[model samples]
Target: MMGNTRELPAPQRGDSWNTYECATVLCAVDGCDHGACQSGPFFVVSISLDEDKVATTIMYSSDTGTWSTPASLDLGFIESDISISWMHGVLSGGALHFILMHDDARLGVLKYDLGTSCLSEIEPAFEIQSARFDSHALIAPEDGQLGIARLSGFNLSVYWREVCHDQVATWTKSEVIDLKKHLLASNPMISHTELVGSVERTTIIFATTNIGTYMIDLKSLRSKKLTSELRLFNHPWALFPYFSFYNPDKLRTRSI
Candidate 1:
């Protein structure tokens, strides 16, 4: 019932990294009974990435303890289709966002504010099954921007959008832009996840089954693969993205 919390080791390529100390947690979004524990400012939800039904639910890890109990959600629980569920997403800037598709759930998108841990239904539920939650919920740089990708069966597509302030409604509205093509040319979002939080020189990094881990460096319009020493699976539970940061201050300090 105890989940693991690990930080990604330093990059072997001598890649320079920086630190902006923060805590992280991952959880299973499926209706699984998997427990979760966290060490700092994060929690993880466990869910089955390749199965159907409630029997596949697993444990979630927030910090370093067991989430024997998940705080009850106050909003309406619009049950998604039997073939749909939320297994993977990201936590950043006190906000937790995930892609919610399918007309059955009644809510197409959902974003939870970590500072409040309150759920807010975004838009009318979408009409797709088992889509990538992280792909569509990726936060973009330049601030207030977000990117999303969708995976329907063998088809995969990516999209880019920005969040703008709505004065009359006091809400941020979505505005799609011409950043990248919807990579339907091949399998893209299939079991892919965006890096939670952000690092300098990069907006998102994820690994796909057949196409090694792809780095989405928004700084430059190009994607690169980092060596081949690591092995990644499509399973959400096994997909661990540990980000290591280097700080000159930490190097000078005796204790980190």
Candidate 2:
């Protein structure tokens, strides 16, 4: 078992992204369970138990301070999977979306909706499988819709969800960009690659090839080399700035 870190506070109402501050506290969970993604605004957190059960803590923050409490969530189908990805959940459409891995190696999404206070699983539009343990992510694209990006061989494919008023969302393939041709043009030593981060509301996807970091534009199918001085091929993680969707004037008047 390991010790918990100090409580991570949300940004202050009027504080700048670089200057916001919140309180901190010890966060100890039973039996060293796993925790995933912090949903924005309400700041809900999901923790999975050793026995496939899942629970959540709804966090509250303001200029005054930060606090959390147990929240009632229906963690549907959380136990049906073999394992959950360590990747942080993506927040879109009023829910925190997590990528789930089945025992057979198929991938699906589990959504915890803050507004409805419910948890549900959304299957991919097609069979999205990974021979690797973790190789996919749920992204909120520039269109403000939920989509999944998967890496297969040297190609990256993105699919978006098309919602029907009274029916389940239908997934459609929106883009398929070949990374091998683009990366080979810049570096011939490129071999392995993986999706790292999706930024600009996912209009851009950052990936690490065998030689360096690269970015792909979903709209134009253009690719660019970000850095070639360092070999970050094995580093599967990245840091991305928070996406702010508020007006500056109105944000100044609100409390964190």
> lDDT tens string, model 2, 164-184?
998868888855677777778
TM-score of 1: 0.45
lDDT of 1 by residue, 175-194 (tens): 33222242222334434333
The per-model lDDT (C-alpha) reads 0.37, 0.59
Question: With candidate 2 superimposed using the best TM-score fit, by how many Å does residue 108's alpha carbon deviate from the native?
Answer: 1.8
For each candidate, give its TM-score against the true structure.
0.45, 0.67
Screening candidate 2 with a backbone cut-off below 3 angstroms (N, C-alpha, C), the clashing residue pairs are 7-25, 13-255, 13-256
lDDT of 1: 0.37
